[model samples]
Target chain A: MVGPVFTWIAEHPKVFWTAAQQHLVLSAAALGLALALALPLAVVLLRWRRAAATAIALVNVLRTIPSLALLVVMLPILGTGFQPALVALTLYGLPAILINAYTALSEVDADIVEAATGQGLSRAQIVRRIQVPLALPVIFAGIRTAAVQIVSAATLAAFIGGGGLGELITAGMGTLDIPQLVVGGLAVAALAILTELAFGLAERRLNRTRHA
Target chain B: MNWTLANYDRLFTALAEHVGLVATALAISLAIALPLGVVSARRPWAYAGVMAVTGVLYTIPALALFALLIPFMGLGTAPAVTALVLYSLLILVRNVATGLREIPHEILEAADGMGYGAWRRLVRIELPLALPVIVAGIRITVVTQISVATVAAYISAGGLGDIIFQGITQDFGEKVVAGAVVTAALAVVADESLRVLERRLRAAQSERA
Candidate 1:
């Protein structure tokens, strides 16, 4: 299994690299889009207590649609390739980021917010200087979780011709090439771990900055 | 464009099937994960190794994992159950370990002082205290599995994904939406129920503590 994996990598270096890049692009684009929508929505939802439950419930629901089904469902509307993959991954990523942002902001110590207000900080200043900074760790945690999940989920992109390492796994399955399957599986596992480590380092840096 | 009671019945039936799959997968996961978690937690080296292995498993993409299993399991519920259980081990084991470790040393000492043996302490004391966090871990696993299990449709496992996949095959939007709607609703209900149970357990434990 290991032998074939190395051989495949050596023989098809360009193919592997292209697939890897596509995988990264899909995951990053989806996560980025989700973050762009989720952050503001989280903020707005947090402000309107009445809407918080409904908003959270909606995202929770969105989160539950499996990525495979989501991709297939979106294929009709968005067609195949990256768009459907992006849409599916984006929806899959939203709940964690949205909930994390909402909870982290809401969890900001009320006393501290009150103190900041008492010190004559404007509401915007309080939110910008205090709440966001305070909530940064938890929010980043959400982002980290979403990023890892998206990286893993992006493999399904291949199922709909979105093209990723999943192609390797799918193809390997077709031929009963255990080595190829292992290579694809290990590559995906490696990618997820590497992305997680990168985010973990970033999280540590953010925490250090917060403390400093 | 005709909305009718029949449509509602189909929707309900679809939801029932989806929830059934989710429930079965979660139950299987719990059955496997809980004992392994407990045994591993009692043995430090074993616990470390189990955690590391499962942590690696946790990162595997659901589709790939299911696809990989197809050679041996040959698709459907067996592969789906196997994949879901494997995906669940990391969360379940870690939470069980954390819960066990978080049990106050003083409490353990008190149990020991009360002449409670290891088995008695673990059964009568440790297990109860760990229930809250363990339940939380289960909640996460169940909810995650509920969503991920939808992918099992690709392998002919048959659930709400049947409708979704059928919609994709035939280019019908309503079926796709119907599948998604049911899946989402099942997740919400299951997640909220588990959360409520977790909270109730935690409150009871706190009152006792």
Candidate 2:
């Protein structure tokens, strides 16, 4: 099994590289889009307590939808390829970041905010200097979770012509090439683990900074 | 609507298979995770080890895991259930351990004062208190597995995912909608129902207190 995997990798270096690159790009783009959308919305939602709770509940429900179904659901609307895949992945990634952001922001210490205000910090300045910094670690944690999940889900992009490591697995399955499938599976697993670890480390560093 | 109505029998069969697959996987996962969780609960080193291993397992993508198992398990419910079971262990074990570990020490001491043996205490005291958390874990596991099981269809595990995939491949929008809608509904229903159960158990525990 090991020898065959190595042989397959050696034989198809370009294909393997392209798939890995696509996987990384798809996961990264989705996380970026989700963060961009979720963070600001979370902040705005903070001003409306009822809306925040309702939105979070809605997101929780949405999160129950499987990643595959979410991805395929996009197919009818966007008609396949990277555009649909990214949109689906972004939606799939949103709930974690949004929920975490809302919780993190709202949970910022009230007394501390008052103290910052007492220091004559303007509302914008307080948010920029205090609230965001305090919320950064939790938001980062949300990012880590979304990143890992998106990387895993992005493999399904191959099914709809989104071109990722999943393509190899599908092709290998079609051809009954066990080694090829294993290689693709291993690559995807490696990417997911790497994303998780990288974010874990970054989150720790963010914590250290916040504490300091 | 027309497409779903026309394919009602097929849809129902697929739904049954999907539910059966998830149920079987959850049962096996709970059986294994419960004992492991109990043993690991009191021992920090053991808990750490169990979590480290299961965390890695959980991090692997469902599709990739399924693909990896296809060769060894030969493309059917066996491999799919195996993947789902592996995916579930981390959540179930963690919840069980946390639930057990979080029981107030005074409560355990009180149980001890009542001459409750270790086995009896665990059976009567610890597990009942931990019920809510364990059920919460099961709820999450069930919802997540329901979603993941759809992808199992790719490997001949047969579920609503088959319809979604078929729709995508065949350019049939209605099948995709039908599959996606039903799958989402199943997940939401499972999550909401379990949440209610968890809440009730928590309320009952507090009432006992």
Tell me, by DockQ, which candidate is best: 2
Report per-prediction Cα RMSD to one decimal: 3.5, 1.1
lDDT tens readout by residue for model 2, A138-181: 88899899999899999999988999999999999989989999
TM-score of each: 0.84, 0.98
- How does candidate 1 fare on TM-score? 0.84
- What is the TM-score of candidate 2? 0.98
Q: Per-residue lDDT tens digits of candidate 2, residues B148-199?
A: 8999999999989989889878899889988988898889999999999999
Candidate closest to the true structure, highest TM-score: 2
lDDT of 2 at A205: 87
Model 1 stretches astray by more than 4 angstroms: A171-181, B1-28, B39-48, B70-78, B104-114, B156-158, B170-172, B203-209
Error of 1 at A27 (Å): 1.2
